[model samples]
Target: DHFVVLFPILSRNRFSHILKGLAMSGRQITVMLSYPSDEVGNHLMDLDAMYKANLNPHTDVLSRQEFRKLFGYTFKHPFTGLDYIDLYMDLAVDNNIEVVLANDPLAALSYSKDVLVATIHDRKHLKNLLLNNGGNTIIGLDELATKQGKSGGYNPEFGLLGSNLAGNNRLKLFPRDAEQFCYAVQKKLFEKTGKTVEVLVYGDGAFKDPVGKIWELADPVVAPGFTAGLMGTPNEIKMKYIADNELVGLSQEEAQRQLKQKISQKGTNLLGQNASLGTTPRQLTDLLGTLCDLMSGSGDKGTPIIHIQGYFDNYASE
Candidate 1:
């Protein structure tokens, strides 16, 4: 049987597991991957070398041999020194595998009609594209664990979308009823202090590292659920612009006090104001979620809940 799997991620364990399963089924698999980098920015080749080679990943469909000849085995990630493409290729032996590098979703149809859509956010769209374009047995990562299992945890809504490896043969699924829990917390806080608080279930940050070029959004979304107070992009003004331009005649200390008053009184009205010129609008949840993610990093801090104070406070506030 011929099966085409659109593989993403650089995890050796996951690669081995998928190959083992496919081999057990006696399926000769063709694993298609995007070039330069995978979907979540796990880069496969040196970006500088790719640019130097004048290879357009948008149009170029590269075989394993072609990629190796051009980039060679010398390209490694700056921080991790991972030769991901070579690693994946080495692991595919004896599994009856042929790896292809292409950007288009329809490219997998050349190898086999039976396709496995393994992307996270692009799974639905990719499945539809494959099915409409001569695909026979199309499945996604989300559908792999939809049903309730007697042994392991399962998310009925998300399925295997937001799962992570806790141990061997064990996964940590996304928290169930996250929206309900957030609402409950908000309600409890309001009743206790008579103040409205926004609560949300956050996973990954919406950010990228300049040095490593690693996009931090491994999860599907930054935040799944948030209170109404956390809805929409933040309307903020540039305090520096106001302090410099608006308070032109004032001295250092006087300008500080005036700036504080101006920011506090500026409120939600910022149309046609020069002070709000360069300020970009970002979603409130994304902003707060990024802050929380940065504060409580993906390390051994063990800090779960983050209490943000003075967020709503102006420069004038004590």
Candidate 2:
């Protein structure tokens, strides 16, 4: 079996040394972006519709323009925050990139360009990129198993449940449970009171426990029971709840004052909770550091590095 380790991080103190060693090992690096498969499929269909409709004049030939327009516009989709995974795939094929690095889920979404257009020659970059993180998640089977044993019964207030996966990490929250219902009620209360509704879901050995911490920062609570059903709530209700609770004590005369304050405070809103992770950021940071160490020692067959000038200059100064 090929032993592969993954490291996900912004940058480390020894990043230069690691990069140099990686390059020496003949590993080719590419940046990766990932997206939900369904989202990508929808985008592709939209591209087809736009191309067939000849929606834009900037395109070359009517047919070719259609493809180009679709290709060009693909980057603008906020779902992935990128226009061209295909371009990256093309570049990877031409340059022979081995490993594709991605810093976050957003970056992963950007690299999805290769899912469709990459050719046989594009295989190396795709292989190395996919291999790096074991396809975006490392399932801790041991954790999932432990969680199942610990969850003797569902915690109604926390929406706790066991997952189908093999590890203790698989415990999940039920989207429609009382915890979610109560949180939704709390959000509405915030709208009425104009104070932040702190919904805390505190239960031991359960993932939903983190919802309380999020509630601590929220204006109103809107915790749902299950992960899959989270999108069902209307965005307006969510905002009203958070605004009412988080904004706290805003009379009509002070409405504008509250709005300005919220704007400055980065009042959490419709978009913010979408990427919520139950684990604290520090936990993730440590995991990434470990993964990086594991990946650094992994082998690379033979690929040349074209060092960027700034990177070369930094090393020269060192």
TM-score versus the correct structure, for each prediction = 0.82, 0.18
Q: What are the lDDT scores of the predictions, listed in order?
A: 0.76, 0.31
Model 1 TM-score (2 dp): 0.82
For residues 1-318, could you state the per-residue lDDT of candidate 1 as single tens digits? Answer: 888878566654334454444555666877888878878777778778888989888878889899888878887767667776656556554657777888888888888899988777788889999899889999976676667768766676766666666665456666667888899999999999999887987877888988777777766677878888788875667887876778888888989888777777775867567878887777888888888898887679774888887776656777
Measured on C-alpha atoms, candidate 1 has an lDDT of 0.76
In candidate 2, which residue ranges exceed 4 Å CA deviation? 1-47, 50-70, 73-75, 78-318
Q: Write the per-residue lDDT of candidate 2 for residues 122-234, one digit (tens) a residue.
A: 23454455546445432211112233345443433222121112232232332325456646766786799985443322211112213212111110122222222223322
**Top TM-score: which candidate number?**
1
Question: Largest lDDT belongs to which candidate?
Answer: 1
